[model samples]
Target chain A: MWFDILPSFWEGAKITIQLTLFSAVIAFFLAFLAGFGRLSKIKAVRFLAATYVEIFRGTSLFVQLFWIYFALPLFGIMLPKMLAGVLALSLNAGAYGSEIVRSTIISVPKGQTEAAIALNMTPWQRTWLVILPQALVMMLPAFGNLIIEMLKGTALVSLVTLADLTFVATVLNSSIMRPTEIFSVLLVIYFVISLPFTRGIRWIEHRLSAGRY
Target chain B: MSVPLKVIYNEESTKSIGNDLRKVAVQPIVNYSNISKSYGDLQVLRNIDLDIAPGEKVALIGPSGSGKTTLARLLMTLEEPTSGTIEVDGEMLWHQKTNGKLVKANEKHLHKVRGNIGMVFQHFNLFPHMTILRNVMEAPRNVLGLSKEEAMERAVTMLKQVGLANKIDAYPAQLSGGQKQRVAIARALVMRPKVMIFDEPTSALDPELVGEVLEVIKAIAAEGEMAMLLITHEMDFARDVADRILFFDQGRIIEQGSPKRIFNNPESERLQTFLSRFNRH
Candidate 1:
């Protein structure tokens, strides 16, 4: 019974990797834009970003899963459920990531902007050259921590019919009635994905804070 | 290179203002006419009509909350005036004259005008992400179109001038507050601004470290090219280095004159009291 799904675990692992990489990239870009929008001086931009964040962050991920997978067909815009799952997880997680990026940017000393202005740098130059670099360095450790959260978040995508690590475990458990074994293996898989991420965060945080290195 | 900044600072640019060699009448570099600024129903500056002559070293001194920083920000165009106009070299600063009517100048205009003015803040606003050399050279390379070699040369020389040559490769976090402020001063001076405004440049420094920065500023003041507008609480620095000192009180220039006239024979009781209790000694 366990052999029924052991042959497909590699396929599931591939999907998990693809989902993690794809969703991480999408979440990062969206989060950066959302963060910048949230901090924008223009009222319209700030409002739109704030509204998007609140909506994504406040709602349940399962509700988003159902809505994107099953509910959106009523609007005549049907997408494959796999795509829907990835989008749902990324967009939901992107909201929290946006806040992380925003806080990092805000934590950057205000003196940095004033210095750029006094040097006669255009606003765009200062953002790209001065502000973004510091913010990126600051955002890296938080992002490393987010990656583990994102790994767990991929589990939510399984509800929309994508055969990820959890889906494979569920299938094997049903076939063999060995729930304990399946669940324990799933725990190991999640641990394998998350442990390095935790260590990477510690390493990065240490490197950044260490002075004169 | 659209404007020959070198031409603006040539031998012909240095004409005496009557008998005073210390004062020059090159051109009306910055004219703030009836310029007033406020923040959320609080009027910070009232009907300011100040004309800074070319090569003038004006020190702005008053108690805290006297609108000195606001005025400095106004001249740097960091904040828009609530009313009236500012002109730099006969060109309207915030709004330009278009077809005989005043209209807002575009970003192009602001860039060109703001290019000519450099200011240093009291907090030494150095970019933390950059190395000290990069901080000094970024504007020169990006805005001034200086080649990497030329920018490096100018940056090194400016670093030497500010006595920060050894710490060029270090980040701001690695430097002392005094070192950071000197690097900031170097960053400003590298651009060769027509007007250099120092907003309490030494106010944040420890007493031991303040002298190095003040000495750098004093040397910059003596070089005789850039006009300096200084905001300082150092009474001796003001009395010794400032050519003219303007006393401000509650967002108004209550009195102004040479440093000796201000420190010795102050016309306003406000100035006398401000000087007596000032304990940064």
Candidate 2:
């Protein structure tokens, strides 16, 4: 049964990898801006970042995907279904990643900031030269985990008829008249996609924190 | 390649201000005219006017609520005055120099003016993520544009003075409280400001460590070439190093005079009782 389904699962995995990788890159870049915006002193900047994070995080990602893929067309806005699905994933994942980014930045010792200021570094210089590099190093593990979650989240896009891994799985199951075997194979494929990313982050965290402990 | 911790500071005197700057050589190094600060409704300081001659040692001695820390913070521009001006080396700082004259200083002006002064906090505010050598050399290489070799040489000499010359590469967490405070002094001093202000530098150290930090401070004062403002809880440290003591009470300078007079014969009854409680040998 496993051997029979391997070829079909392999086909499904290709689209899953593309959706996850494309969304992850977009989400990672947007999260940096959103996270730093939340830390901005200007009220408007801070409010905008907070509003974006809250609007995205408070709602379900699946609902968000549906709105982009299914609901936007009624408002006279037209977008490709595949494009809409990736946008929703990136936006939603960015909201969650921004919080992780913020907490990681704040966790750095305040003394480092004081030291930077004492050295007469401009605010921008301090952010990039002193703060952001350290913050990026700290964010990687959490971000890596988020990427894996986002990969799993791409399964919801199957409902939009994107022909992603989940959609292909459902089609194969119906055609072959075997729900349990097809579903189990689908689950294993998702696991195969996620587990290595999870382990990679763990290995990174261990290597970075190795001798510090 | 490094040594133990020593006296670190924000003012790296050796760079621009140097050890032998005369008050009148260029102009006044420090002038705080009618500076005031308030946190919400609680006014920490009001109507403070002060001037420090070059290389003079002024110690601020007061009870806990007497605005000692606030004064130090104000001078460092860590907290700006609600109303008034702060000038450094006779240039219009903490305020804009308008029409070839002085106007009320704002944040931008303070940024430039404050670049010339350095401060050391009581809690040692050392960068925990950085090693002691990096902490010592940061401002010099970054702000002062010192070559790595130059900053390292200064860092070593400063550490040697503070007696922590052996722990130069150690992290703050690895050092004792006294060691951390000394590294903080080196970090501040690396900038070579005209004046150095230490706010309760020894208060947080273990008793044994306090004396070591004080010894470094006393050596700084005795050098008699760098204007220093010290805020300390140690009566002996204050008396030993301070040329003059500004005894503050209730947000006011109750009295200011030579340490011998203030510590021995006080003009105010408030000072007498306050000093008496801790006046033990």
Candidate 3:
């Protein structure tokens, strides 16, 4: 019976993995864009970035997923279900991640920027070459936590009738009447999928922090 | 194998004449005119006028909060003066000329002018994440657009000059305070700026470590190719390295003269009293 359900679980796991990765890519770019925007010298840019961060972070991700999936169509802008799920997850996660980026960038000592300026570096060069390299090392652990949160957040997508792991498990449990065995298997699968992400972040953190430690 | 004596003599005479003409045409490498800065109501710098000639070594000595570091910071564009203009290599630093009028300089103007200046901070702000060689090579490679090979060559030579060639691969945290400061000096020196500003360069080091850092600075000053503005509390080091010294107190330069006159003559009561504190040791 375990072997029979394993194949179904793998199919569902694939969808969950895909959703996590797609959303993570979008979230990563948004994290940097909003992060740097919040610190931008232009007032309008700062305002826009702050608004995005606050709106997403201050509200519930569950409602955001619903709004994107169910509410966006009211304005005649219909996104496919997968894109909607990915969009909501990324936007929500990116908001929280931008704060991580902003705070870590801020925590990089002021002297680093001054030193870069003293070298006659342009603002872009200062940010990319000097500031970000240092900020990145500090940002990884927080970002690691965020990635895991995002991975877990993918379980929410099953509610939108997506055939992700949790949705498959629920369907299987109802049909087979084996809630105890199937749910335990479902729990193990999620934990197994999350392990590599945590390990990968640690490996990257170790590599980036090679000399400092 | 010898050249004609008369030919050598004529060449020397013409070279001397050229030197005289060049001196008249050359503007001060760094100039500050009527500069002042304030944080809210508390003013840190008052109306001040100063000039640093090419290859000149000027030391600023004063009490804490006397605004010596502020002078260097203003020149480096780290802090904007509340009023007045600075010029670097004959170009306006804080203001640019537009349509025969002086307008506050933009980022492009400041970047161009600032390329002529380099600063070493008291904290030796080497990028902690970079290896020593990368820290020194980064600006020249990215900012100056030097090729990797060229930047690497320059970085190696500079590290060697500072006696840290063996530690090129080391991170800043792995080095002593003095070693880190030496890497910082090499990082600045790699830029080959017309003016180098040292803001209490050795102040953050251990007592025994100070000598190594000062030795690197002394060697650089001895090259006599770059103008140096050193703000330091090391009285003896200032006296040794400075061609001229300015005594700053309460945001103003109370006295300025050769190191000998500034140290020995003791004209101002404030300067006299200031020197006495160091003299006590």
- TM per candidate comes to 0.91, 0.87, 0.92
Candidate 1 lDDT tens digits, A47-66: 99999899999997788878
Could you tell me the lDDT of residue B187 within candidate 2? 79
lDDT of 1 by residue, B101-132 (tens): 77887767788888878999999888877899
| DockQ of each model vs. true complex | 0.60, 0.40, 0.66
Consecutive 10-residue window with the lowest summed lDDT within model 2 chain A:
A204-213
Each model's Cα RMSD: 4.2, 6.8, 6.3
How many angstroms is residue B85 displaced in model 2 relative to the true structure, after the best TM-score fit? 1.5
Write down the TM-score for model 2. Answer: 0.87
List the candidates ranked by lDDT, beginning with the highest.
3, 1, 2
Q: Could you give candidate 3's per-residue lDDT for residues B108-188 as a string of tens digits?
A: 999998999999999999998889999999999998999999999999999999999999998899999999999999999
| lDDT of prediction 1 | 0.82
Candidate 2 local lDDT, B89-196, one digit each (tens):
666566675796667765566667778777777677776556888888877777677999999999888888787789987878788888888788877877777789
Interface RMSD of 3: 1.1
Cα lDDT tens digits for candidate 3, A1-213: 666677879889989999989998899899999999999999999999999999999898899999988998999989987888899999999999899999999998899999999999999898888889888888888888888899899889889989999999999988988888888889889899889878988898788667483
Q: Residue B97, candidate 2: how far off, in angstroms?
A: 2.7
The docking category that best describes candidate 3 is: medium
